[model samples]
Target chain A: MSKHVAYTDFIDCEEDVRIRAKDQARVVALREKKGWLFRLLLGLVLIGPGVLVMIADNDAGGVITYAQTGAAYGIGFFIPALLLSGLIAYVVQEMTVRLGAVTHRGHAEMIWGRYGAFWGWFSLVDLVLANILTLITEFIGVTLGLGVFGVPHVVSAAAAIAVDVVVLLVLRYYAWERVSLWIALGNLVFIPLALMSHPHWSTVVSAFSTWRVQGGFTPAFLFIVLANFGTTIAPWMLFFQQSAVVDKGLTVRDIRHGRVDTAIGTVAMVAVAIALVILTGTLVHGMRGASNLDIQQILSVLGQRLGPVGEDLFALGLVEAGMIAAIALTASTSWAMGEAFRWPKSINMPARRAWRFYLPGLLSAVIAAAVVLIPHAPLGFLNLTVQVVASIFMPAAILFLLLLLNDAAIMGEYTNRKWQNAAAFSIVGLLVALSGVYGLTVAMPHLL
Target chain B: MKKDTLSLVARTDRMAPVELTKAQVKGWVRVVFWGLRVYIVVMIVLVAIGFARGQI
Candidate 1:
């Protein structure tokens, strides 16, 4: 056993391979059947990781960031800017889908193997820290969401942790993915909230043609842009989606369907983000220090402006965002740790068998849940700092991803094409520029 | 069962480790890696400063 330990991998683990193969075998069955109905059903079955990662992309912090953006700048510039970030989200995430489908490995394992131990350890530590902090924001969203209904933070925290544990330990991969997808639909509650707010339809439409910032270029504006970018794509997303794709048993053949899954998810994420911005922008825009206000303050003003029904809807959406994101984030943490340490890491494994894999993820969630319960914890400050950290870390994460995608020895025929490389590199450049602006703004307060 | 589809998941060694040699990490790749390392460190320091001053 000790001699074989170094070769331990996710698929190599008995439980993981058995469950994944069982699930993928069914997808294969679905593909063999004729008719559009089977195709439709197959589409639903195949749309797991990509969609979950995308919807969960618009996590609790993301919801607040979009809401804050709307409340600050209203709907002119960010409307289109949000959509472009969605495109960026697609470009970055799609690479993971291909990488997973071709390589059948988690992002952590790929980095660990291909780049050597130092880079591997660096990426894993960065991701785990990022995931934990992001999970804290998710819990804050959960508490704030339920607190609107008179639920205490302690109760909300307990309930959130319990639900996450149940969802992870109780379900198999297929069941888990289906259940997660259904839960993710709750994120769309923002669409109804946006519609009910009665945002100026003409302004929303005109935003595309005009594409002009309400306040012109400023450091504050740039920081907000980076924040939105941070919300749209984060380090956890890359790890979560790729591991998910591999666990779901996607092969080179399923890459087309995987892209379909990802495309649908991108559309949903962008649309919901737009709804968030529109809902808050229409009602809360022009308030004093709109950008500076946290979610709780924004919610207070939203209640006053839109009445209890609107407030209640937004609250529910916040809870859903937090819940779905916590689920994805927890699993990603476990999978990354498993890949790094060679533990049996699959949602399909019984908790008893894969306790090592399950332990780290559960502990991270518990820590985050505890953090949110601290009185005077500066949740808003923490939220901003986490976003800044993630934004700063984006280029490094994408650089590793770009490197993995280009390695022809492993990817073989699946290697990234020139266009793909060019697009991905440009995204890295854009993130670096965004990060630089952030640094410049901080270093020289007078400079934009 | 379609063996090809099931084959994707049935195996384990498909993702065996592939460590790079010292000679492999070179040229623009080396420069880019060094540049990114410096970039990440600087950005983190700047963010720490911003957060400390409450300007970010």
Candidate 2:
């Protein structure tokens, strides 16, 4: 009995301390490696969804929102306001990294397992619907972008669809992430377009100090603010990043790197958004009643103001933004569906084994493409509806995320700190209020 | 069999229940859950009314 007791004590000691200590040691050693350049390169290689989600957040619809903001309101108030949205995006997305790392479960799977089927199905339906609607907008951006160069809508849609299929199907998860990252890098084209506009740099900087909206807080101004908020953070971003982190096999050790990845993406997202705002604000805002112009009219104004080269570059940025977003949104839909239905979910899965996972996304793209090809398909209403649905659904999605983060059973020692919970809930309140105001505006335009 | 039993015993010991109570954490969740639900329902009703009145 004495001998047995001694042996059990040794085993307990090993379990209580040795394993984690070894892991901690390994992590420390890995971090202690010398050479800053090597570390940067390693981070670039390691980062995935953090960056992708941010860039993808600035999608086709988002570009138009920012452009319209510039044309309508100019760089007066939105410059700092949009910059602040980057921080909001970071705070929301950071939780996704931690959740993915600690739990090794996608958001849908976690919600379904913990929150019961009602919320699970609710989340799934919202995600799939929003994704499809968002994809149609992406196809719109692609067609319009290419149309400026005389590419027919049919040809543009087909080409975009083909490229998306090949990227999603032919490559495994890591390979797909890398390929998408390269495409995401192309989103920087807007930076140069902003620079090329040659705006009054002092006025742009001084807007930060002045910090005033051009007009007072009228209904029109509030509408644009709501649009900006809707575009910055959406339900798809939450699903996409968490699933990407899990699929990438990120563990707690990788959380720091995941954060850096997301930080880089946030910077890129806001930079491009602000650049578009600048480009449009500088060049297009001068036209009489330019705020009322549609996207086509905005593009036309760009052509007239910036000349052929600048216009072409802006168009290229729009096309790149749409294509990259399509990739992310498609993966997000596939991951969610896979989690919901118990299908194989990883981008790492071979086409043969994961066709069910890929099919939902592919079919969604095809349907969106077909819809975009329809002549005069109520694109305006579709855009407004997408915004409304996203706003209405935002609070619910955020509620689930916060609940999961706080759950002791799921998060173990990694549950949110008290302040994190406070900040997160505050954001939820703001979102709910925004959704309510948006709802009122949509339902009773006269009241607004 | 003896080794396996010992490891299982060790595992359970290492994964002892956390410091926070499930009920305590769940209190916040229930509040946010109901709150968001009420908000969504209100929004839907307003939009429905708008559509009915040709406002949307």
Give me the candidate number with maximum lDDT: 1
Model 2, range A1-448, lDDT digits (tens) per residue?
Answer: 2223334464444222222232233333445578897677567666778989999888889999999999998899999999988888898999999998787678888878777788788899989998999999999999999998999999999999999999999987778988999999888988999998898989899989999987698889989999999999999999999988877756676888989999999999999999999999998886898889888888888888788897888788789889999999999999999888867577777788779989999999999999999987987777777887798788888888888788777788889999888988888888888888878887778786
Q: iRMS value of model 1?
A: 7.4
Isolated chain B TM-score per model: 0.57, 0.54
Off by over 4 Å in 2: A1-38, B1-26
Q: What's the CA RMSD of model 2 in angstroms?
A: 6.5
Model 1: colliding residue pairs = none
Q: Each model's TM-score?
A: 0.92, 0.88
| Residue A211 of model 1, lDDT score | 88
Report the Cα lDDT for residue A370, model 1: 95
Candidate 1 A-chain TM-score? 0.95
- Give the proportion of true interface contacts each model preserves, from 0 to 1: 0.31, 0.24
lDDT of 1 at A96: 98
TM-score of 2: 0.88
Write candidate 1's Cα lDDT for A1-448 as tens digits.
Answer: 2223232344454556555667776776788789999999998889899899999998998998899899999999998998899999999999999999887788988888777798888888888888999999999999999999999999999999999999999998889899999999999999998998899999999999998987788778887888898889898999999999888878888889999999999999999999999988898888778878878898988789889988998999999999999999999999999988878778878898899999999999999999999999877677766777687767888998998888887778888899999999999998898878878787667875
**Which ranges of candidate 1 are over 4 A from the true structure?**
A1-15, A287-292, B1-23, B51-56
